[model samples]
Target: MQQQAISTEQSSPLTLSVALQVVSAIAVGAALLFVVGFAPMDVAHNAAHDARHSFAFPCH
Candidate 1:
């Protein structure tokens, strides 16, 4: 009979690398949403508006 070694510590599903990636992705998404979705500045809004038109997004 072969016996396997049992781990005393439990492994976490959300590791350090995964947590960092999640945070970075959230930051990037928030930045994009803020800059493009509803930009306060005119230049940013115009740029995003052009991009939306290019993508066929109807924005009045």
Candidate 2:
């Protein structure tokens, strides 16, 4: 009788690195757009109001 083994240790690290890179990119893009696109006080306020309602963040 013979036994076979499967290995996953080699592929997980590369997958994790790629996932982290993608998340970092999305975060950077969101930050840049929010900061640069909403520099004015009124614009920022309006955007926040809309976002709060859309996402149900509850700003009160």
Candidate 3:
């Protein structure tokens, strides 16, 4: 009877790397969505105004 050894060299690292990347992407995306989505209209406009002023966009 011959016993065969399983090699996980190709599968394990690749799977872990992909899983980490996916989790990280989801986390960052969710944070951005929360920041953008939960803002009131006036607050959002004011933040944009401040940003524009910082960049010297001349909104006035």
Using TM-score as the measure, the top candidate is: 1
Question: Which 10-residue window of candidate 1 scores lowest in summed lDDT?
Answer: 1-10
TM-score of each: 0.49, 0.43, 0.44
Clashing pairs in 2: none
Cα lDDT listed for each candidate: 0.61, 0.56, 0.55
lDDT for residue 60 in candidate 3, whole number 0-100: 45
Q: Model 3: how far is 37 from its true place, Å?
A: 0.7
lDDT per residue (tens digit) for residues 1-60 in model 3: 011112233356666656666676787788875455444466765767666556555454
Kindly indicate the candidate among 1 and 2 with the higher lDDT.
1
Judged by lDDT against the true structure, how good is candidate 1? 0.61
Question: Candidate 2, residues 1-60: lDDT per residue as tens digits?
Answer: 011111233355766656666676787788876654544566675667766556654444
- Candidate with better TM-score, 1 vs 3: 1
Ranking by TM-score: 1, 3, 2
* Number of colliding residue pairs in each model: 0, 0, 0
